[model samples]
Target: MTGGNWLGLSGKTIVVTGGSGGIGRAILRGALDAGARVVVLDYDAKTAEETAREADSAGCLAIGLGCDVSDTDSVAAAAEAVAERWGGCDVLINNAGILRPGPLEDLSLEDWTRMLDVNLNGCLIGSQIFGKQMVERGGGAIVHVASISASQPQPFSGAYSPGKAAVAMLSRQLAYEWGPKRIRSNVISPGLVLTPLSEAFYKDEDVRRARERLVPVGRIGRPQDMADVALFLASDRAAYVNGQEIVVDGGLSQTLMGTVPRPGYSG
Candidate 1:
């Protein structure tokens, strides 16, 4: 795998939602590094600016866009902008998601809906809008960022897990419907990556070690780890890898850690 590149997306236009997030930025960087034009759609303008600047410095065409993937009108406008600016993207990476962590007992309906709005519905809307264009232009690729929580359970994972699980199923449905048009769809479930979202837990050495023990990989996931897989799924190299949910969490999912939370002990 190290001997050569996965696939070249040169001359391709890509749209990366939540491009400002930890893994989102990494995916954008990977695609841009591959000489592809990327449109970064992020909710936070500041973070989006940073991503766009980095891509621009790399001499790649990257547009920083503010978009609310949950809102119909918002997504419509964002998609329009992407189509207008890039004349349609060849790849659409739905990486935008929010984690509202709270005990199921204390969680509110508003919290649950918000999580679904951005995580599941957002991607669904993006797929419909962008997939139409891709289908018209012959074909395209869509890689969604799901979570191991979708399959495995974590404490206080109520909304996040269910929402992500829905996203995985959504990808499967989209794949089935869009495959005839050569529009491939896939999902990536990443485990405990050291991202801004998860940095609080890792900030404490003891906590970090405890978290690592839970992952059979002996360490938490990395942004680049997910990015590498994403690059493959988005490129022509993964043309045959459609409707598949590739869990890129090292060997964490394979290990059964049991009910008790044990620190510094990798199964």
Candidate 2:
């Protein structure tokens, strides 16, 4: 089939942040393939437009808009535009974020604030803007793209982990407050997913194998792995699911303790 057959997202309008490429693009494509009219919200208008065109070619209604999630006015304007065009969004994938890796001690205040602003505050802003519409319309879903780092902190990752941790909590808070209106919110925490930005790191055979070894599944994750979870969270299939985080890390979290040397076990 030409379109996605994963869910009943046909004709639904979805707004995805940072959909110009990588995991964000994968999510956008998944929604489009599922027959949803998508909006690619990104800081770069050109790349967003390019992505939109590609989706449109696949017989999906897609648009690109430049938006800074940290800026309320920018987000409001984007929301207004979406409302005017698609009558309002049915789903929102708050996937915009940045990973500024550095030691917490060496990280500048500006870096920390920026990470929080984009990763945490960005999700809140998108939810509030689109979620208001969802509430008024009587129901909708918000899926956040938090990282597995949220729960398992990594050294030298700076504020990235902290910001994602807040995102997970933010999603839960929104779910608690918005569930009354039938608006569901959830978080998808991914681990070691291969994306455009990080593809180069995996080019080395040893590096790739080493990374894959860390996952109990014996392989790394793909963007589609996270996208599939996001689509499920946004669809009716997960109607009862809310205020929760679905870890898409190939059981890596489960093996954390096992990786440590045990008294009776041989390494």
Index of the highest-lDDT prediction: 2
Write down the RMSD of candidate 1 (Cα, Å): 3.2
lDDT of 2 by residue, 126-188 (tens): 999999898777799999999888999878988988889999999999999999999999999
Best by TM-score: 2
Model 2 ranges off by over 4 Å: 1-6, 58-60
The segments of candidate 1 whose C-alpha lies over 4 angstroms from its true place after superposition are 1-6, 58-60, 257-267
Q: Which window of 10 residues has the lowest lDDT sum in candidate 1?
A: 1-10
lDDT of 1: 0.85
Question: Candidate 1, after superposition: displacement of residue 59 in Å?
Answer: 6.8
